[model samples]
Target: MLRAAAATHLRRHIITQRRRIATPESIRAVAVDPSGSLTPRAVDLATLRKTTGAPLRDLLNLDIGERTRRQRRACVLPRDKAVLLQLGGLTAVINADEALFFDNGGEERPRAALRRIGASVEFAFQHYKAPAFELAVLEAVLAEVSSSFQRRRDLYEPVVQKQLREASCEFDGFGVDGLHRLSAFDGALMSFEAETRQALQVLDELLASDEDMLGLLLSERRAGTSVDPERHGVVELLLEAYHRRLSAVAGDVAELRGKVQAATELGRVTIDLNRNNIIKFNLYLSMSAVGLAATTSIAGIFGMNLVSGIEEAPLAFGAVTAGSGLVGAAVVAGFHAAMRSQKSIEQRARHAADDREALTSLLANMATVENVFDDACRDLTRPAIAARLEAATGKKPSEREVEILFDIFDASHNDKISLREARSALHRGDAHPLIT
Candidate 1:
């Protein structure tokens, strides 16, 4: 019985000790006094107000009770001699020498913001030891803004540098793989710009709004004829830092835009060059097809049942077959040469037709430089002839089609008609096909 009683007592003692171990609560409030000392035992809102001598009514402005609707806000209640600041879940009443902090220390809180504010406040307390409410506010805000900008710079600088390096390296040999890399870098840059803008804007608004207030507070404290050096120094430093980061990012974005443009243009140029090569290849294939057709025609004729007397001689069969093949090849070569010569004659005639009109028109004005003007006239007329021929045919005219149109127009020209009138006649002829 005594042993069992002792065991029960030991169990009770263990439970009591566990209860006394004091785990941290979700909601907590702490107060700090003028001598840079932290208060023992977290307090409630009422206790926080009582200890810091700040009015409890200001807590309503913080909107702390509701978790989802919290926002970052800061206001100086000069009449109460206090500053109320709420950044995410952390709210603080910053007085002349003491501060009361209320933190919703839950898992979903803005832990980074809270940590930044805490570290800034602690830094001020440890360094300045007797900083006023304005200095403390400045210290906290500067730390957050400076650290935030620096953090972003560190994070993005390497990425931007890598993108720049890749772009430079790939520029010489930009192709399909380079295009893919550029597209991915473009997307990443867009995301970075979007995310960085929000933070940059917030800090900008804060700095603009509080510049006067900080200046006034520092001026009153220093009683110097000169402007508040501390206010200018810190604010300007942060402003310059943020500005430098923005400039770097903006410059990188512009450079990437240029790179993307050059890459796109290069891709288009390559496509155009490839298309021209394909068109040239197809033209060669057409010429080869014409040659092959000639050879096939000769072969088909000899394969027929009708026989020549040469079939009776032993060497006649070989000689006739060989002669037929050679004749087919010779026909193809003659046809190609004839076509080429015709193309050249038509081109010359087209140029001469253009120059004839221009030379006639310029003859009355320019007597001395007729030779120089003749060459210029020829170049200008060549394209005009091609255009008119195309319009009259209602299709891209081949060498044969162009020659047919030229002959059709020649009669109109003989009748003392203008080129446009000849073109109209040809167009009418093409439009009105023969019933047969």
Candidate 2:
């Protein structure tokens, strides 16, 4: 009696364990026929999981199923005969011909998904709305991604053009909105690239894997049937075509990236030019203030408590006033001459036919005015200026030669450089041969 009770208790415990079910989430399982007929039926999550052998956790947590969760465009699980595809704003799942379309409480189906994969297949028995072939499901995913990107590219290109057009207009330049738009577009492209790469990777794996062959042979073995080479060839051909299509799309993405980079470069140059003009205006204002300050200092000195004998003379007041006026005028004239000379040098350098000469002239002005060359002379590690010099001359310039060039560049004016003076300076300093 004791043995009988123990056996019965163990059997009851086993029965309870077997009856335990996973969490209940309602789902629709649509059975697809090669005859192009779809029969959708509602099923519980547990039943669906059992039927497809897909993990319940993976289905619930979409990220768990992703090979590249953060950046994956598509994922294929050929072992389970399943695929997860993100197309536009929709995510679709395919288990061979049967699919579980996640509705997210929406009324309308993903038109992009349905249009590509849901073609009519007429079998000997009947006509059904289903994927014509197993590979057609993957093709739909690719089509949706390509179409979405094309639409985005079309919308984005015009915006970029507008930004480029308005680049000349200071107030209307691609200031904030342009940057935001570009960032958004770039992000979209990056996502597209990642998805395309993932898709290609999956296809390549599929082509290399013996898993499909094993599955086919195993199923046939169970049924006591033979393998069909023609059916297998069709799958291989479709896979190759898909790979080629992805390769072409990748090329398009690369071209788009290039155009965006060019547009960004132009925008940056415009901003830099605007900044330089502002700097020029500020320098002019500072020079004016300095001249006025000089005049004020002279007047202040004359107004001191100590009276001179010249104050008693009739013409003393006028002479002192005239002397102060002349002093201020001289200071202003000197500043104006210096600025004018600098401007002339810059204009000449910009218009120079020889790039080397132009670069030298530019460096000269920057050396004297901005003291860039002084710092560079002290520190040989200034690679930016070094690079500029090398590009112009096709040779790495020595520190001493760079210093000599700075002095000669400063002296250049109106596209004319005193080559004799430069050569003499080079001889005295570095003994480097002048380019002239």
Best by lDDT: 2
Off-target runs (Cα >4 Å) in candidate 2 are 1-21, 28-32, 35-40, 55-73, 80-97, 104-108, 120-133, 136-177, 212-233, 303-436
Task: Kindly report which residue pairs in candidate 1 clash with one another.
Answer: none
Q: Report the poorest 10 consecutive residues by lDDT, candidate 1.
A: 365-374
Number of clashes in model 1? 0
- Tens digits of per-residue lDDT, candidate 1, 1-436, equal 9999999999986664344334322345555553434553354455444544455556545533333332245343322345565531246666656566664322222333444455566667678746554556545644554444343333333434554565455545543334444454445445444444544554455556655345425324445455454665555565556556655555554565566556556655665676788999999999999999999999898867667666788898788789999999999999999999999978876765554333232221111111121112222233454454344223343443234323433454443323343424323221211111
RMSD of each: 31.4, 24.7
| Cα deviation of 319, candidate 1, in Å | 24
Candidate 1, superposed: residue stretches over 4 Å from native: 1-117, 133-148, 160-174, 195-436
Weakest 10 consecutive residues of candidate 2 by summed lDDT? 366-375
In candidate 2, list every pair of residues with a backbone clash.
35-121, 36-121, 36-128, 36-129, 37-128, 37-129
Listed in order, each prediction's TM-score against the native is: 0.37, 0.51
